[model samples]
Target: MDGEIRTRFKTICVYCGSNSGNRAVFSDAALDLGRELVKRRIDLVYGGGSVGLMGLISQTVHAGGCDVLGIIPSALMPIEQISGETIGEVKKVSDMHERKAEMARRSDAFIALPGGYGTMEELLEMITWSQLGIHDKPVGLLNVDGYYNPLLALFDKGVEEGFIKTSAREIVISAAKANELLEKMELYTPRHDQVASRTSWELSQLGYSKPPI
Candidate 1:
């Protein structure tokens, strides 16, 4: 068990915004994250795009001679500037659902960088999946420049409000920097059963009749 826990993950799925914000720090952090992933010899699994922070990260990883795998929807391919040829592999899908599924399938862990609604949606789905025992992968948030602080507080509020399980909160590891976040993830183990139990309890609190499985 110890050996398995300590085993290095081969792939990580990164969710970041397609638009680089006004702050240059966001881009810098993205680059640092990319370089660190390469330093740690981890493969990058991401949305296939060549713009904004996503492109910056992919370019950095490729320049560092690390493996990068992209999954993109066919419709948004041209818009995202899909650089299918430069990366290790690119899998084009029919829609957003397929893209997310493919990305999850290819990754051992999930990380969210500064992003918009799309990125948040992807991260949330992965977290829900982990809670439901669909997957036992670690999910991390790179809170660069306190970008995710508000969201973190909101998550805590959910727990307080009885909407989100406290144990589910433990499943997400948060860090202000890339290296630290990755280091913690290196030691992550999914607490799916705990989360699922908590979710069940939360459901019961809502007075919803539990269906016999």
Candidate 2:
């Protein structure tokens, strides 16, 4: 196992949609997560923007007196529609690679709200990094309305097919509610952590280089 639970997160990275999805609860989860982060006094690190679920959480947490750091890629500014409404310090990076790197570097842990490809990309990258030992921070899903159930099923499929080990699959934490998820994250300890010490090049043939992403 990794170790004892971390007492303080300091900052948490969140990946979410630039567009609020079809459901009100998706937005509700975003707001709820924002409030939960504030309640815990954890700063927010996320894809930078002032719209959709991203905006909701950033504005909510910032309003609640928590620092928010928004890291964005230059290529996505026009796509995410950056505006004067941004709630916190915004750092511009060259591309998606830089943006993801910065978010992972700044966050103590990660949370994913309902989103699209970009959101999934960020989430999966974090999970991959954890599996590769680039980072061992907790990675979680808000599973709003069981939105992520299909992904979970796919992961199970990976395990059953002998592509993903049972122990490696345990790194991800999922919950229906914000508080529950956060608690799970704080209590999480990494197993199979030693695999991270091996380079991806050495592990790729072992079918350990990446997740389903």
Candidate 3:
């Protein structure tokens, strides 16, 4: 166990869309999450981009005097423009795979806001890694504006279809608002058996040899 639940995590990884959604509310939610992170003195770990919701969240956190660490691929550096120099360190990596790996290594928890395919990719990778016992960090979804309701339902469907175990689904805490989700994260304790069991079962079902961890 990670011991006592700290009021503020040292760093939290946020996965959000590179493009802000059509609704102003989505932007508002992003801003709110940023402010909340700042108020708690939690550092932000994310894709180093200065566009759309990604920029909004990072900038807002910076404005609130919170630390922001960005890990961006070298290719996107020219496009993302890297935000505030005063907030925290920004490390440019060779590619997207490296970017995601570094961000995961740096964060204590993971939160996914409304995003597109890229965001989904990041979140799923985190989940898979957690399932593999690569890390025991907490993972959550900020279901702002009911944005993730359908996806949540789909996860439930996965459980029903036996493609995903109920225990694996339980690893992800979700809330319609940021504060609630953060609270749940503070209380999180990863279930190692659940993670191991699912990984072993999935590997066997796929007829693939499970790699020794």
Candidate 4:
């Protein structure tokens, strides 16, 4: 217990590609992140798919004696659930909206691995949710091998152009490795002014309760 890492998150949702990228580094990062989560005794909530990075990470976490929950949209079930390769408890939602809401409701924080459009979409939505005060959970990027440098630069450009506020930009935490990213996320505190009160949002469907004042 001398060098154990403590985390505030019980379940963290991960957004990643259903298909592993061309490079081996992407797959490696996914596995590394899974190990880190297991080491910290944190459960995982991710897009349901037992292929590519999704499969790698889910299997790693499940094998490490941690809970793994995969939430997938009904429409994509056929594509994502190939060859009966599903891992852990799988939840099917009516649509993408429902899937995302369920994932958010179940997770305490979020992380995005190197992925395509779907991954970017999920990551941005979480950040937007934080900006809108739907939740104050930390959203992090496992920026493995500079995979997210361009995206980060784009974010900085948004700030320079007054499209994004300074405090809101801080909502996204990034690092090149899982351990460092998680450490930073553990220290994250929301400093941005929410567009609306968290309780004001009609998040009942997502099972989010209003915080006690």
Candidate 5:
């Protein structure tokens, strides 16, 4: 057994909005992501709540008989908690920072669905972590309806400005479909170890993250 090699991804972390955006495509993408996880037998780790995209995905995955974990800060419960039944296990932490740490700790890969500020912050933080070598797990954007095009442009601009390295920009992988994204992420090899680290100033303000939902 000691010589046995395990599958690289058993559980995936998803960062999404507390509120579902005003687009049917967004909800459809979240549902597709959940269904894909179930089909792959991959569990879920995400912000705890039953409202918005979080609820839609978790519930979809749970209904498909997949294990789902929801982690949320105690204080944010009033705003993020689901009204009816919640799928799988739900963990409540003391604060937002703990919530994020718990989510990151339990996941093997990360995907971002179309969302608002909370989703952006969570997704960006994960990319930053990968950039800093805190973890080399794959981070992906669902990019539904090209919602993340602007964000991608921003990263490119950072590269153009000479602040972000060309290599660092590769930290984020994306796909329009859930299965394709997962497949790409599965093939992802950490290139960080192959290259020198960027300056601390370039990754300044990098530390523990707190999601604002």
Candidate 6:
């Protein structure tokens, strides 16, 4: 850990499956991401859970001396919790909307690990928020083992079909490995034009004190 490089992000929100995928690579990638965060002295904000990739990454980051925060919807608490051993600081929100909002407000950036509908939903919202100028934070995808290849391609297709603006395609920073993804995200700059002024968006309603300047 000598001469460790400092990261621009103080905390990053990670969206991953509550169920670890069939392959070991997914779990490995999640743990690797956690270690990278610790190395960079960055903390973690994630969906609250005590199983699967969520548990793996959270425990790894917490054990590495970095703060870990888990935000979960009240309805999911019973499903995601394990033996009454949720890690770090757990915040229970009233619903999914509040859960996602809290996660965004607490983190400086985001990373999406290979997951199912819920994970993709969270990732897409962050990207949409960036598109609308709600926040300029980097949104990264840990495309482990090419799991996200199709989704990435679909995004490209959107750009090609005119459904998505060309500039907005750069909103999702992606890489196959945790180290590479973090490196890419650290250098990410908001190149896309915002749909509206951030001030006009009334960000305080989402728990943000102020939008990124």
Local distance difference test, each candidate: 0.81, 0.85, 0.81, 0.92, 0.82, 0.92
Better of 2 and 3 by lDDT: 2
Estimate, for each residue in 1-213, the C-alpha lDDT of model 1 and write its tens digit.
111223377888999989998999999999999988877777798997888999899888888776888888889878887445555577888899778777877788899999999999999998887787556778999999999899999999999999887777888899999989988988886553543442344333223254212
Which stretches in model 6 have alpha-carbon errors above 4 Å? 1-3
Could you give candidate 5's per-residue lDDT for residues 36-59 as a string of tens digits? 887787899999888889999998
For candidate 1, the lDDT comes to 0.81
Model 4: worst 10 consecutive residues (lDDT sum): 204-213
lDDT of 6 at 65: 88
Candidate 5, pairs of clashing residues: none
- Ranking 5 against 6 by lDDT, winner: 6
Tens digits of per-residue lDDT for model 6 on 94-204?
A: 999888888988899999999999999999999999999998999999999999999999999999999998899999999999999999998999999899978889788
Over 4 Å off, model 2: 1-7, 198-213
Candidate 4 TM-score, C-alpha based: 0.96
| 2 against 4, candidate with superior TM-score | 4
Number of colliding residue pairs in model 2: 0
- TM-score to native of every candidate shown: 0.85, 0.88, 0.85, 0.96, 0.86, 0.97
Please list all clashing residue pairs in model 1, or write none if there are none.
Answer: none
Query: Model 3 over residues 49-77: C-alpha lDDT tens digits?
Result: 77889889999988877788888788888
Error of 4 at 180 (Å): 0.3
Q: List, in order, the clash count of every candidate structure.
A: 0, 0, 0, 0, 0, 0
Clashing pairs in 6: none
C-alpha RMSD (angstroms) for model 4: 1.7
